[model samples]
Target chain A: MSLILAAESLAEIINSYAECDASSVAIAAVIHVALIGAFFGLPAGIFIWAERKVSARIQDRLGPTRVGGRFGWLQAVADGAKLVQKEDLCPKDADKPLFRIAPYVVVIASFAAFMFLPFTDGWSAVSLDVGMFLLFAMLSLEVIGVILAGYASGSKWALFGGMREAAQMVSYEIPMSICALIPIVMAGTLNLNEVIHYQSADWIGVIPPFLHWNVFHPVAGPAFIVYFVCATASCKRAPFDLAEAESELVAGFLTEYSGMRWSFFFLAEYASMFLVSAVAAILFLGGWDDGFGIVRALKGNSTNVLDPGVIAGNLLGAGVLMLKASKLVLIQIWVRWTLPRLRIDQVMTTCLKYLLPMSCALFLAAVVYPMALVLGTGRPQILPLSNDVSAEAEMSTSSEVEVERAAADGEVT
Target chain B: MTIDQYLFALFALLTCGGAISVVICQNVVRMAFSLIISLASISALFFLLSADFVGATQLMVYVGGTIVLLIFGVMLTSSSALLQIRTSPAEGFLAAGIGVLFLSVFSFTVWSVDWDRNEAKLAGVTAVDVPPQDYNEASSGNTVRPLAMSFVGLRPDKAGKAPGYLLPFEIVSVHLLVVLIGAAYLARTKRRVSAES
Candidate 1:
């Protein structure tokens, strides 16, 4: 929905300056698509470099020290150039067409998932009402491509890897989704922007605004931990990366892939890692809400996109959001380097026996917490932080009115 | 043509093409892949209609969940001999005949319906109860609230005049739970028997 608004506004701006025969919406869309492409691609490259450096530091060894100077910041670029020049090959036994198409499917699914993710206020490409749900749906599509890649590779290791991935991803999704719902239950909306708005206000106008985030909520704090764990497993990162257990499977589903094809899988992996981390940041950490509340002061309830203050605030929010998400991503990388990979059975057990029940309990607590508070006190919130008392009262009264009206209508019928 | 029209044309063509390919493909895996394409495109059509929640649900439940399970089942159960089963000509003909008959009946029923009149009737039922927040707006397209309200027996679209599907929804939920439990129990018993043997 935001796509249409952005495009229409861009079109209006273009028309005021000059006349063009081309469709303005199409032009705007192309530009947005290009921006999104860069957003999706550049992060994967940087994350790859970070992963290497972080792992090297942990191992007490220098990693990629000379690729693009001392820190080897351009190592990912060098690797990409090399991969581009290398030959793309398909095994003779493989299903040729499916094998070729699988990497693209993975890339596209990961990229599409970004459309629903709001980096800052009013900045998502597609602002669907079911933003979180649609994002999950898009992310889930990635597994299909992995499964196809495994099967189409026509190797036993590849098939095993695919089967493991299918089982792991599908099982973990149940817990991950439930964990996500903990915040949704608290926020009372599925729109990511609305969820962030619910966390935008400071606690008691004295405490830091960041403390008001869902992560600080008693129930949601534990749920965030579980969500991050499941997010790691979903991204096929260790200690749950049984799908690509190097010693056992020779890169598993990627055994047959090389060159640009192989890099596509890496790109998808890093992008999804970043995507889930960003989602966690939005869902738990105060997304784009710098602890200082300076951005909110700048925004000041203005809905106008053209406002210079709003733009500055949004840009700052975007920076904060990216920083938080990047930190989470770093933690994921740290966990990958530090922990040993779990066996397939252990991974399944961790999800099914532990994480699933834990997340379910968190979800129940989140739901009951507010209701319990409402019953105990006059207000729904235990903390007399914000103006939630009046808001909760207004909501209850409106619902009560709705119930009365429904009862009257029933009698008439 | 407008962008919407062009998009509709694209997805519609892909849907039909995928369905046709599913039938024509000799390999079971390839057929499953085509089925995924068809189902995903159908979800895209739902999105185009501004049914955002339904579209996402369709993509998640069918394309993401069901198709993955179907592919997994195919890969696990099939041996090399069973991978490419050839249908008998007689069976093929019988199946094609049944499919054609079903298609004809569906088309005939669709063509016979006065869609405009039906739409007017639906609008009449819903018009008076249109909430302050317009859910059908292209920009917001928020149907989740209304959908949830209706599921819980409050028919927001009908101003609480019509009965909601709360009872049936509960029944279906219970039915699914039963099926899940039964499947687990059955699988457990088989594993125990195999262990004993």
Candidate 2:
């Protein structure tokens, strides 16, 4: 079910039956919050397992052969159990309160970001109009926890790790936000669901629906590549993992953390990795829409929430989104193992000297592309798609009308 | 109370508590941390008020960008000796006196305002003159487009009679550029002097 509608319906059912507004709303909120919490944790567990297995295969070794069958699918669960059992340790010199609180800050920031992400059409926990902006804001809050963890540890390694994270995250956010804006410029809306709807129609009728994605656009294609690079760095994965460079900083900000306190950091990291990948999928790739449009066909003008076909379509759409996101995550894992980590200076140089300028140029190109198309083809869009071009034209004409009306009023006065 | 009022009360308490913590905390890092909490809860208040764009911008700019840089500076420049700077009791008393004075002035101004009359005036103005669609968008928390348009000198909500904020926006951008260049220059000069020495 679309979570928003489901929540409303659940509340309505309770209100009709019991006739208490506050209790009905409260009950619905609790149930949905629990549902979203499970959804948040499940992906992190699965991805952690995938990370270990993928890294193991790349290095030519058997990983976790003894747990949950030969494939060791339950290895992540075992690891969690082990981590939970370990003693939580705090350094004597550490700022104890801040140290204890830091990991929760990181975990909460990433989990809250998930609330803004839609798994399928209208499936978000909170369907704000400015979902993407709010999501980015929430994601940026994770750095504070890392910085606190580093500072509060009172260890030199942790301090250095925290400093590196502070500098790196601050620097990389520039190019990352600019790259994200490229798609927003194209779609002319900050709403992720609207951006998905803009990409729903097939290009040129005979072309596949997948090609309708923004990544195929001449400008957004390069922006996507830069965005992925910046995203990897932003997540502090390998090649840009200077903040937690184990060889140099002895686990960086994580040097003083142990047990579940430490596991919270990892959970936040893996969850954010998945979040950014899902965002890239939604923005550059088609979000939950299958490439074949089979899901759309299944949904087929059904507004009824309990319709079996709509339910199936939503499930299928969510599965497709997850598959796309996981594939991206696998690529991230592949890059982590296959590539050597960059030096701190090199990482900064890559973002500042290369990605920053490149993303800016891409933003400019994205702005000009439609204007150039309109000039050349006498239409705002060149592709034989749906109502997007009309929508654009209508927006332009509406503004033009306002301007004309203003001008006429001035003359009359 | 409704959920919105409950949330407002909660966040308002958090905001005040964080501000108090900032004033009381001896450790500089702890002070900064409390300041973050205060600013973040203020953003929560913005969200509760249905100013979604403003709330997000507050989070992004102040809590994420500005305070992180402030803490970064604190960590980089402070030696162990300077980590915790204790204020004298006299200084504390002076600060508290000034704070009380400021609070009284603020409360006086707030109390003097006829808020209901102003709100009614605003409603009367917009209701009669502005189209319902424009008014709806302004009130609906979907202010991104209207805000962007107004920044570019098109007040869709005002029927285009009033000039938008384009001039002031450009001035702020240029002011920010100047500050950036000044900072870069100062850092560069300091580095050159250190290298020469």
Candidate 3:
């Protein structure tokens, strides 16, 4: 979070220095793009390394222990160096231009989705109001690149893999989106940042603030399970990895891809895995908020003068968020290793038959729960904040002590 | 040019270039890919126009759903080697001439409109006084709410002589239901005579 603030302040400083209108905006935009790239690129490298080590541990074996000494942490870097030296290949019957351009389309679509995801309170590359919807839109574009890669490969196996992927992905989107919507309904906002803020309050004014997370709600509890299942399927991870069934389809859509091009697809894959987990963290679990409220205490006491305490708190918040998201990713890797891959037909049936209807039922219950609470108990499931979430956020920024006093008073009475 | 104008130019180039490629390409799959590019650029154009919800919908529905279906249709019907379908010279010439004429008429109609004056009148302000709200804030509010409200028979954004979208929305929904059933019926597989063999 401090990193984002520092980048923003740096951009402001540039704007002040330039005193020019369009150039400053351009410069700021460039900086933002650079920041996004660095954020995305660094994670891709780290996640690949993490995936190897975690998967190896799951399989009861040592993994990549030679390259970087003690933990072989730099294995991904070595792998990248080797990959760049390999020859880029193109099949004789392939569509040259489409084959060449497919990897970039996949990478761009995946990277663009990260723009709308908030790492912490008010920390994002672009905080769109329709952030969730836009993220879905960007993610959906990844299918186009996969389809192109398959068709352009001019291999029968590639075509089969591509078509299977297209079908599975398109079908899974319905359930995934419906499950995601349950949290939105609970939060009463499409903005991911606001959604997190909504969870900061106590549940129905009785339970602890940490338990106020949407996943704890009965309707959202089932919805979170549905969401994780759909999210796994969406990311094309096992057991839903029908697209790249290595045993049957010969690496499926990836048969013809080699060198950096092949690695680009994996980069997109791992990044999206991290991304969906982060989204789940923010939506279902409390985002950047410690379940214990220790971070909240720090946040409530620190002044906004960019003091050491404030910076430490912000960094702690970001670290907590990343840690939670990483835990989800680790679970994904664990599932991938433990579960057997499903057949294409079974995958389709699981989504359309099971998850779709289940999500719909959960959505109905989520909507009805509030009405039931209002009618029976005469109180909503989640207490309405007297001040808007953004207003409270603003108060925290101006004078933290007052915000803490107000919070304490509200909690007591 | 400002960043907005520069972005507009970039997106416009992509949209026009993609459209041209879609028309000129002989291979069905290539044309479909080109159409995806065109549709995606159109979505970006929507973003540049400060219509984020519309842009996202375009990307999701058109680029994601429709184009994938189009590619599936092409793949299912044609062999890999025969994917390229050449157009007759006479038909190509006819299409080119009609396309040029259509473009000219559309450009003429657009240039003839007093759009700035109409917007000024709507806001009840001079062009200079127009607050840069719509121009600047690309992703501030959830545009979906107003759009949803309009679909459900409300026109809160327009106070005078505004039409609700309820009827159209319902009609579209029914139309989609019909399409779904029809497509399912058409796509049902026929059992082969394996017993005879």
Q: What overall lDDT goes with each candidate model?
A: 0.85, 0.84, 0.79
Reference-based lDDT, residue B35, model 1? 94
Could you list the CA RMSD of all candidates, in the order they appear? 3.0, 3.2, 6.7
Q: Write the number of the candidate with greater TM-score, choosing between 2 and 3.
A: 2
Interface RMSD of each: 4.2, 6.0, 11.8
Worst 10 residues of 1 chain B by lDDT: B131-140
Model 3 Cα lDDT, one tens digit per residue, B13-65: 99999999999999888899889988998988887776777888898889988
Q: In order, what DockQ does each candidate have? A: 0.42, 0.39, 0.31
- Model 3 pairs whose backbones collide: none
Compose the digit string of candidate 1's lDDT tens values, residues B1-197.
Answer: 66567667888999999998898787889999999999999888877676778889998999999999899879977975688888788987898999999999999999999999998898776535555242125444567877887788776666666788899999999999999999778756344576888
What is the C-alpha lDDT profile of model 1 across A189-299, one tens digit per residue?
Answer: 788987887777744556666767889888999999999999999999999888789899988899899999999999999999999999999999978888678988898
Q: What would the per-residue lDDT of candidate 2 be over residues A1-413, giving only the tens digit for each residue?
A: 11222256568867888987667877987887788788778988999998888889999997767789788999999999999999999999899999999999999999988887888977776666678898999999999999999999989999999889878988898899999998887777777877777677633467777777888888888999999999999999997999779899999999999999999999999998999999999999989988787887888789987799999999998898899888998899999999999999998899899999999999999999889998999776656645443255447746865775575466446
For residues A41-105, could you state the per-residue lDDT of candidate 3 as single tens digits?
78778888988998899899888898888889999999999999999999998989999999999
Local distance difference test, candidate 1: 0.85
